[model samples]
Target: MRQVIPLGTVTMTYPGPVREQPLAIELHNTLYAADGEPLDGLADERGLRAWLGAVRGRLPAQARGADPRRLADVRRLRDAVREVLHAATEQRPPRPSAVRAVNDASRRCPSSPQLGAARGGGMRAAIDHHGADATDIALGAFAVDAIDLVTGARRGALGRCGAPGCVLMFLRDHPRRAWCSPACGNRARQARHYRRTHP
Candidate 1:
Protein backbone atom coordinates (compact mmCIF):
# COMPACT_ATOMS: atom_id res chain seq x y z
CA MET A 1 0.00 0.00 0.00
CA ARG A 2 1.13 3.56 -0.70
CA GLN A 3 1.77 5.93 2.19
CA VAL A 4 -0.06 9.23 2.47
CA ILE A 5 1.53 11.59 4.92
CA PRO A 6 -0.37 14.38 6.57
CA LEU A 7 0.24 17.67 4.78
CA GLY A 8 2.94 19.58 6.58
CA THR A 9 4.00 23.15 7.08
CA VAL A 10 3.55 25.00 3.79
CA THR A 11 5.62 28.06 2.94
CA MET A 12 3.99 31.10 1.36
CA THR A 13 5.65 33.25 -1.33
CA TYR A 14 5.00 36.73 -2.68
CA PRO A 15 6.69 38.83 -5.35
CA GLY A 16 9.40 41.36 -4.80
CA PRO A 17 9.28 45.07 -5.55
CA VAL A 18 7.96 45.44 -9.09
CA ARG A 19 8.11 48.36 -11.48
CA GLU A 20 4.98 47.03 -13.13
CA GLN A 21 2.30 45.39 -11.07
CA PRO A 22 0.80 42.00 -11.97
CA LEU A 23 -2.00 42.50 -14.47
CA ALA A 24 -5.57 41.82 -13.44
CA ILE A 25 -5.92 39.10 -16.04
CA GLU A 26 -2.70 37.51 -14.88
CA LEU A 27 -3.83 37.51 -11.29
CA HIS A 28 -7.21 36.02 -12.21
CA ASN A 29 -5.79 33.14 -14.22
CA THR A 30 -3.02 32.47 -11.73
CA LEU A 31 -5.37 32.08 -8.80
CA TYR A 32 -7.86 30.03 -10.78
CA ALA A 33 -5.20 27.66 -11.93
CA ALA A 34 -3.87 27.33 -8.41
CA ASP A 35 -7.24 26.60 -6.88
CA GLY A 36 -8.87 24.52 -9.59
CA GLU A 37 -8.08 20.79 -9.56
CA PRO A 38 -9.98 17.82 -10.96
CA LEU A 39 -10.88 15.74 -7.89
CA ASP A 40 -13.56 13.68 -6.21
CA GLY A 41 -16.70 14.77 -4.28
CA LEU A 42 -16.33 18.19 -2.63
CA ALA A 43 -13.03 18.72 -4.35
CA ASP A 44 -13.91 22.36 -4.55
CA GLU A 45 -14.19 22.59 -0.78
CA ARG A 46 -10.89 20.81 -0.30
CA GLY A 47 -9.25 22.99 -2.90
CA LEU A 48 -10.72 26.11 -1.34
CA ARG A 49 -9.05 25.30 1.99
CA ALA A 50 -5.77 24.78 0.23
CA TRP A 51 -6.14 28.09 -1.59
CA LEU A 52 -7.00 29.89 1.65
CA GLY A 53 -3.90 28.54 3.32
CA ALA A 54 -1.88 29.94 0.45
CA VAL A 55 -3.60 33.27 0.89
CA ARG A 56 -2.79 33.24 4.59
CA GLY A 57 0.82 32.63 3.73
CA ARG A 58 0.90 35.49 1.24
CA LEU A 59 -1.21 37.96 3.14
CA PRO A 60 0.04 41.48 2.48
CA ALA A 61 -1.33 42.56 5.82
CA GLN A 62 -3.17 40.93 8.65
CA ALA A 63 -6.91 41.05 8.34
CA ARG A 64 -8.28 43.64 10.79
CA GLY A 65 -9.56 40.62 12.69
CA ALA A 66 -11.01 37.22 12.07
CA ASP A 67 -14.62 37.61 11.09
CA PRO A 68 -16.46 34.35 11.57
CA ARG A 69 -18.85 35.62 8.97
CA ARG A 70 -16.04 35.39 6.43
CA LEU A 71 -15.99 31.65 7.03
CA ALA A 72 -19.51 31.53 5.71
CA ASP A 73 -18.38 33.63 2.76
CA VAL A 74 -15.61 31.15 2.13
CA ARG A 75 -18.12 28.34 2.05
CA ARG A 76 -20.29 30.30 -0.33
CA LEU A 77 -17.35 31.17 -2.54
CA ARG A 78 -16.16 27.56 -2.46
CA ASP A 79 -19.46 26.36 -3.84
CA ALA A 80 -19.47 29.11 -6.44
CA VAL A 81 -15.91 28.36 -7.52
CA ARG A 82 -16.79 24.70 -7.97
CA GLU A 83 -19.90 25.45 -9.97
CA VAL A 84 -18.07 27.96 -12.12
CA LEU A 85 -15.12 25.72 -12.88
CA HIS A 86 -17.37 22.77 -13.67
CA ALA A 87 -19.53 24.90 -15.92
CA ALA A 88 -16.55 26.31 -17.79
CA THR A 89 -14.99 22.91 -18.36
CA GLU A 90 -18.35 21.55 -19.55
CA GLN A 91 -18.83 24.63 -21.76
CA ARG A 92 -21.97 25.75 -19.99
CA PRO A 93 -23.01 29.11 -18.66
CA PRO A 94 -22.47 29.96 -15.00
CA ARG A 95 -25.61 29.64 -12.94
CA PRO A 96 -27.23 32.79 -11.56
CA SER A 97 -26.24 31.76 -8.02
CA ALA A 98 -22.64 31.37 -9.10
CA VAL A 99 -22.65 34.71 -10.86
CA ARG A 100 -24.14 36.45 -7.85
CA ALA A 101 -21.57 34.86 -5.55
CA VAL A 102 -18.77 35.98 -7.81
CA ASN A 103 -20.08 39.51 -7.96
CA ASP A 104 -20.63 39.68 -4.24
CA ALA A 105 -17.26 38.29 -3.26
CA SER A 106 -15.44 40.49 -5.76
CA ARG A 107 -17.21 43.57 -4.47
CA ARG A 108 -16.95 42.67 -0.81
CA CYS A 109 -13.42 41.32 -0.66
CA PRO A 110 -11.33 44.04 -2.20
CA SER A 111 -8.64 42.72 0.14
CA SER A 112 -8.15 39.87 -2.32
CA PRO A 113 -5.46 40.53 -4.89
CA GLN A 114 -7.12 38.84 -7.89
CA LEU A 115 -10.45 40.56 -7.46
CA GLY A 116 -8.83 43.93 -6.76
CA ALA A 117 -6.95 43.84 -10.04
CA ALA A 118 -9.95 42.56 -11.96
CA ARG A 119 -11.91 45.47 -10.59
CA GLY A 120 -9.71 47.68 -12.75
CA GLY A 121 -11.83 50.25 -14.53
CA GLY A 122 -12.76 48.28 -17.63
CA MET A 123 -12.76 44.78 -16.21
CA ARG A 124 -16.26 44.58 -14.78
CA ALA A 125 -17.67 45.84 -18.04
CA ALA A 126 -15.90 43.08 -19.88
CA ILE A 127 -17.27 40.50 -17.48
CA ASP A 128 -20.75 41.91 -17.98
CA HIS A 129 -20.40 41.65 -21.75
CA HIS A 130 -19.27 38.04 -21.53
CA GLY A 131 -22.30 37.10 -19.42
CA ALA A 132 -19.97 36.12 -16.54
CA ASP A 133 -18.85 32.82 -18.04
CA ALA A 134 -15.10 33.03 -17.52
CA THR A 135 -15.21 35.40 -14.61
CA ASP A 136 -16.88 32.94 -12.27
CA ILE A 137 -13.72 31.65 -10.62
CA ALA A 138 -12.22 35.08 -10.94
CA LEU A 139 -14.30 36.26 -8.02
CA GLY A 140 -12.57 34.01 -5.47
CA ALA A 141 -9.25 34.69 -7.08
CA PHE A 142 -9.89 38.37 -6.70
CA ALA A 143 -10.41 38.01 -2.99
CA VAL A 144 -7.25 35.97 -2.62
CA ASP A 145 -5.28 38.44 -4.75
CA ALA A 146 -6.49 41.28 -2.57
CA ILE A 147 -4.93 39.49 0.37
CA ASP A 148 -1.76 38.87 -1.63
CA LEU A 149 -1.54 42.51 -2.68
CA VAL A 150 -1.79 43.63 0.89
CA THR A 151 1.20 41.44 1.60
CA GLY A 152 4.47 42.66 0.10
CA ALA A 153 4.66 39.34 -1.80
CA ARG A 154 2.43 40.41 -4.68
CA ARG A 155 5.25 41.23 -7.06
CA GLY A 156 6.68 37.97 -8.49
CA ALA A 157 6.68 34.96 -6.18
CA LEU A 158 3.03 33.91 -6.44
CA GLY A 159 2.28 30.50 -7.94
CA ARG A 160 0.82 27.01 -7.44
CA CYS A 161 2.79 23.93 -6.49
CA GLY A 162 3.54 21.82 -9.58
CA ALA A 163 3.03 18.48 -7.84
CA PRO A 164 0.86 15.99 -9.74
CA GLY A 165 -2.38 14.67 -8.19
CA CYS A 166 -1.76 17.04 -5.32
CA VAL A 167 -3.78 20.22 -5.56
CA LEU A 168 -1.75 22.01 -2.90
CA MET A 169 -0.82 25.72 -3.05
CA PHE A 170 2.52 27.43 -2.40
CA LEU A 171 4.43 30.56 -3.23
CA ARG A 172 7.51 30.54 -5.46
CA ASP A 173 9.89 31.45 -2.65
CA HIS A 174 12.31 28.99 -4.14
CA PRO A 175 12.88 28.17 -7.78
CA ARG A 176 11.13 24.84 -7.19
CA ARG A 177 7.72 24.62 -5.49
CA ALA A 178 6.19 21.65 -7.25
CA TRP A 179 4.78 20.28 -4.01
CA CYS A 180 3.36 21.66 -0.84
CA SER A 181 5.55 19.34 1.20
CA PRO A 182 8.44 16.96 0.81
CA ALA A 183 6.00 14.16 1.61
CA CYS A 184 3.85 15.02 -1.38
CA GLY A 185 6.93 15.21 -3.49
CA ASN A 186 7.90 11.76 -2.33
CA ARG A 187 4.44 10.36 -2.99
CA ALA A 188 4.51 11.69 -6.50
CA ARG A 189 7.89 10.11 -6.97
CA GLN A 190 6.67 6.78 -5.67
CA ALA A 191 3.56 6.90 -7.80
CA ARG A 192 5.73 7.54 -10.80
CA HIS A 193 7.83 4.53 -9.83
CA TYR A 194 4.76 2.27 -9.71
CA ARG A 195 3.56 3.60 -13.04
CA ARG A 196 6.93 2.98 -14.66
CA THR A 197 7.12 -0.56 -13.27
CA HIS A 198 3.51 -1.56 -14.01
CA PRO A 199 3.08 0.13 -17.36
Candidate 2:
Protein backbone atom coordinates (compact mmCIF):
# COMPACT_ATOMS: atom_id res chain seq x y z
CA MET A 1 0.00 0.00 0.00
CA ARG A 2 1.10 3.54 -0.70
CA GLN A 3 1.86 5.50 2.45
CA VAL A 4 0.79 9.11 2.82
CA ILE A 5 3.00 11.22 5.04
CA PRO A 6 1.58 14.40 6.54
CA LEU A 7 2.68 17.76 5.25
CA GLY A 8 5.87 19.09 6.80
CA THR A 9 6.07 15.88 8.76
CA VAL A 10 8.31 13.89 6.50
CA THR A 11 11.94 13.48 7.35
CA MET A 12 14.63 15.11 5.22
CA THR A 13 12.23 17.35 3.38
CA TYR A 14 14.52 20.21 2.54
CA PRO A 15 13.33 23.55 1.25
CA GLY A 16 14.20 25.14 -2.12
CA PRO A 17 14.99 23.80 -5.55
CA VAL A 18 17.36 20.86 -5.71
CA ARG A 19 18.91 21.76 -9.01
CA GLU A 20 19.97 24.98 -10.65
CA GLN A 21 20.60 23.37 -14.01
CA PRO A 22 19.44 20.57 -16.29
CA LEU A 23 20.71 16.98 -16.04
CA ALA A 24 22.79 17.20 -19.19
CA ILE A 25 24.73 20.04 -17.71
CA GLU A 26 25.45 18.36 -14.41
CA LEU A 27 28.85 16.72 -13.99
CA HIS A 28 27.23 13.33 -13.41
CA ASN A 29 25.03 12.63 -16.39
CA THR A 30 24.23 8.96 -16.15
CA LEU A 31 22.63 7.09 -13.27
CA TYR A 32 21.98 3.41 -12.73
CA ALA A 33 19.82 1.25 -10.55
CA ALA A 34 21.15 -1.66 -8.53
CA ASP A 35 19.55 -4.05 -11.01
CA GLY A 36 21.49 -2.58 -13.94
CA GLU A 37 18.63 -0.58 -15.35
CA PRO A 38 19.93 2.20 -17.59
CA LEU A 39 17.76 4.75 -15.75
CA ASP A 40 17.79 6.52 -19.08
CA GLY A 41 14.82 8.84 -18.66
CA LEU A 42 16.20 10.54 -15.59
CA ALA A 43 19.90 10.70 -16.33
CA ASP A 44 20.64 13.49 -18.81
CA GLU A 45 19.97 17.27 -18.63
CA ARG A 46 16.31 16.95 -19.40
CA GLY A 47 15.84 14.79 -16.33
CA LEU A 48 16.70 17.57 -13.88
CA ARG A 49 14.42 19.92 -15.73
CA ALA A 50 11.58 17.47 -15.31
CA TRP A 51 12.37 16.96 -11.62
CA LEU A 52 12.29 20.67 -10.73
CA GLY A 53 8.79 20.85 -12.10
CA ALA A 54 7.67 17.96 -9.92
CA VAL A 55 8.92 19.38 -6.60
CA ARG A 56 8.23 23.08 -6.89
CA GLY A 57 5.94 23.53 -3.93
CA ARG A 58 5.56 22.87 -0.20
CA LEU A 59 4.12 19.70 1.30
CA PRO A 60 0.35 19.14 1.69
CA ALA A 61 0.69 20.77 -1.67
CA GLN A 62 3.98 19.11 -2.33
CA ALA A 63 4.57 17.53 -5.74
CA ARG A 64 1.93 14.97 -6.56
CA GLY A 65 3.12 11.41 -6.58
CA ALA A 66 0.36 10.61 -9.04
CA ASP A 67 1.57 13.25 -11.42
CA PRO A 68 2.91 11.67 -14.60
CA ARG A 69 6.20 13.41 -14.05
CA ARG A 70 6.58 11.98 -10.57
CA LEU A 71 8.49 8.87 -11.59
CA ALA A 72 10.99 10.87 -13.55
CA ASP A 73 11.43 13.22 -10.65
CA VAL A 74 11.97 10.34 -8.26
CA ARG A 75 14.59 8.87 -10.52
CA ARG A 76 16.39 12.17 -10.74
CA LEU A 77 16.22 12.57 -7.00
CA ARG A 78 17.83 9.16 -6.56
CA ASP A 79 20.71 10.13 -8.77
CA ALA A 80 21.18 13.31 -6.83
CA VAL A 81 21.15 11.37 -3.58
CA ARG A 82 23.92 9.15 -4.83
CA GLU A 83 25.93 12.14 -5.94
CA VAL A 84 25.56 13.82 -2.60
CA LEU A 85 26.49 10.60 -0.84
CA HIS A 86 29.67 10.29 -2.84
CA ALA A 87 30.68 13.82 -2.02
CA ALA A 88 29.97 13.49 1.68
CA THR A 89 32.19 10.44 1.90
CA GLU A 90 35.32 12.00 0.46
CA GLN A 91 38.57 10.88 2.08
CA ARG A 92 40.28 14.24 2.25
CA PRO A 93 37.65 15.53 4.69
CA PRO A 94 36.16 18.97 4.65
CA ARG A 95 38.64 21.78 4.95
CA PRO A 96 37.85 24.64 7.28
CA SER A 97 36.67 26.69 4.36
CA ALA A 98 34.47 23.87 3.13
CA VAL A 99 33.12 23.33 6.62
CA ARG A 100 32.28 27.00 6.72
CA ALA A 101 30.35 26.66 3.50
CA VAL A 102 28.43 23.65 4.80
CA ASN A 103 27.52 25.58 7.90
CA ASP A 104 26.38 28.49 5.82
CA ALA A 105 24.21 26.24 3.77
CA SER A 106 22.68 24.62 6.80
CA ARG A 107 21.99 27.96 8.43
CA ARG A 108 20.20 29.10 5.29
CA CYS A 109 17.54 26.50 5.97
CA PRO A 110 14.22 28.05 6.87
CA SER A 111 13.66 25.09 9.13
CA SER A 112 16.86 25.05 11.09
CA PRO A 113 15.69 22.90 13.97
CA GLN A 114 14.48 20.19 11.71
CA LEU A 115 17.71 20.44 9.80
CA GLY A 116 19.67 20.16 12.99
CA ALA A 117 17.82 17.05 14.00
CA ALA A 118 18.38 15.47 10.63
CA ARG A 119 22.03 16.35 10.74
CA GLY A 120 22.35 14.51 14.00
CA GLY A 121 20.34 11.35 13.35
CA GLY A 122 17.07 11.91 11.55
CA MET A 123 18.58 11.57 8.10
CA ARG A 124 20.46 8.40 8.81
CA ALA A 125 17.33 6.90 10.28
CA ALA A 126 15.27 7.93 7.30
CA ILE A 127 17.71 6.32 4.94
CA ASP A 128 17.78 3.21 7.06
CA HIS A 129 14.06 3.02 7.63
CA HIS A 130 12.22 4.36 4.63
CA GLY A 131 15.20 4.24 2.35
CA ALA A 132 15.52 7.27 0.08
CA ASP A 133 14.89 8.47 -3.38
CA ALA A 134 17.49 10.58 -5.11
CA THR A 135 16.29 13.75 -3.46
CA ASP A 136 15.97 12.19 -0.04
CA ILE A 137 19.26 10.38 -0.40
CA ALA A 138 21.02 13.53 -1.43
CA LEU A 139 19.46 15.30 1.51
CA GLY A 140 20.55 12.49 3.82
CA ALA A 141 24.13 12.79 2.68
CA PHE A 142 23.96 16.55 3.06
CA ALA A 143 22.55 16.24 6.56
CA VAL A 144 25.30 13.89 7.63
CA ASP A 145 28.00 16.12 6.25
CA ALA A 146 26.42 19.20 7.69
CA ILE A 147 26.61 17.61 11.12
CA ASP A 148 30.14 16.48 10.49
CA LEU A 149 31.19 19.90 9.36
CA VAL A 150 29.30 21.89 11.97
CA THR A 151 29.12 19.60 14.99
CA GLY A 152 32.54 18.02 14.45
CA ALA A 153 31.51 14.46 13.55
CA ARG A 154 34.17 12.11 12.26
CA ARG A 155 35.53 12.94 8.81
CA GLY A 156 36.12 9.32 7.85
CA ALA A 157 32.42 8.45 7.68
CA LEU A 158 32.00 9.97 4.23
CA GLY A 159 32.88 8.38 0.90
CA ARG A 160 32.80 8.60 -2.90
CA CYS A 161 31.35 5.83 -5.05
CA GLY A 162 34.13 3.93 -6.78
CA ALA A 163 32.30 3.39 -10.03
CA PRO A 164 34.34 4.78 -12.90
CA GLY A 165 32.32 7.50 -14.65
CA CYS A 166 30.02 7.58 -11.64
CA VAL A 167 30.41 10.49 -9.28
CA LEU A 168 28.16 10.43 -6.24
CA MET A 169 28.35 10.31 -2.45
CA PHE A 170 27.32 7.72 0.11
CA LEU A 171 28.23 6.86 3.67
CA ARG A 172 31.10 4.48 3.94
CA ASP A 173 29.73 1.44 5.72
CA HIS A 174 32.77 -0.47 4.64
CA PRO A 175 36.05 0.09 2.81
CA ARG A 176 35.00 -1.54 -0.45
CA ARG A 177 32.13 0.37 -2.06
CA ALA A 178 33.38 1.20 -5.54
CA TRP A 179 30.18 2.16 -7.38
CA CYS A 180 27.06 4.04 -6.46
CA SER A 181 24.85 1.06 -7.29
CA PRO A 182 24.90 -2.36 -8.81
CA ALA A 183 24.08 -0.95 -12.22
CA CYS A 184 27.27 1.04 -12.16
CA GLY A 185 28.93 -2.11 -10.96
CA ASN A 186 27.53 -3.94 -13.96
CA ARG A 187 28.66 -1.21 -16.26
CA ALA A 188 32.15 -1.57 -14.90
CA ARG A 189 31.92 -5.29 -15.36
CA GLN A 190 30.70 -4.95 -18.92
CA ALA A 191 33.46 -2.56 -19.79
CA ARG A 192 35.91 -5.13 -18.54
CA HIS A 193 34.07 -7.81 -20.45
CA TYR A 194 34.31 -5.89 -23.70
CA ARG A 195 37.96 -5.08 -23.19
CA ARG A 196 38.90 -8.66 -22.46
CA THR A 197 36.85 -10.07 -25.31
CA HIS A 198 37.95 -7.49 -27.84
CA PRO A 199 41.62 -7.64 -26.96
Who wins the TM-score comparison?
Answer: 2
User: For each candidate, how many residue pairs have backbone atoms clashing (under 3 Å)?
Assistant: 19, 19
C-alpha local distance difference test of each model: 0.42, 0.39
Give the lowest summed-lDDT range of ten residues in model 1.
Answer: 16-25
> Model 2: per-residue lDDT, tens digit, 1-199?
1112243443222221232222211213334333444444344433433433333342111112223334444444344433343444543344444444434433433231222255556652212313233343333333344454323454454444566654444444566766545666788889899999999
Q: Model 2, stretches more than 4 Å misplaced?
A: 1-90, 93-96, 109-145, 149-157, 172-175
TM-scores of all models? 0.37, 0.38
> Model 1 compared with the native: what TM-score?
0.37
Q: Per-residue lDDT for 64-87 in model 1, tens only?
A: 122322444555665665455445
Flag regions of model 1 displaced more than 4 Å: 1-62, 82-96, 109-165, 169-182
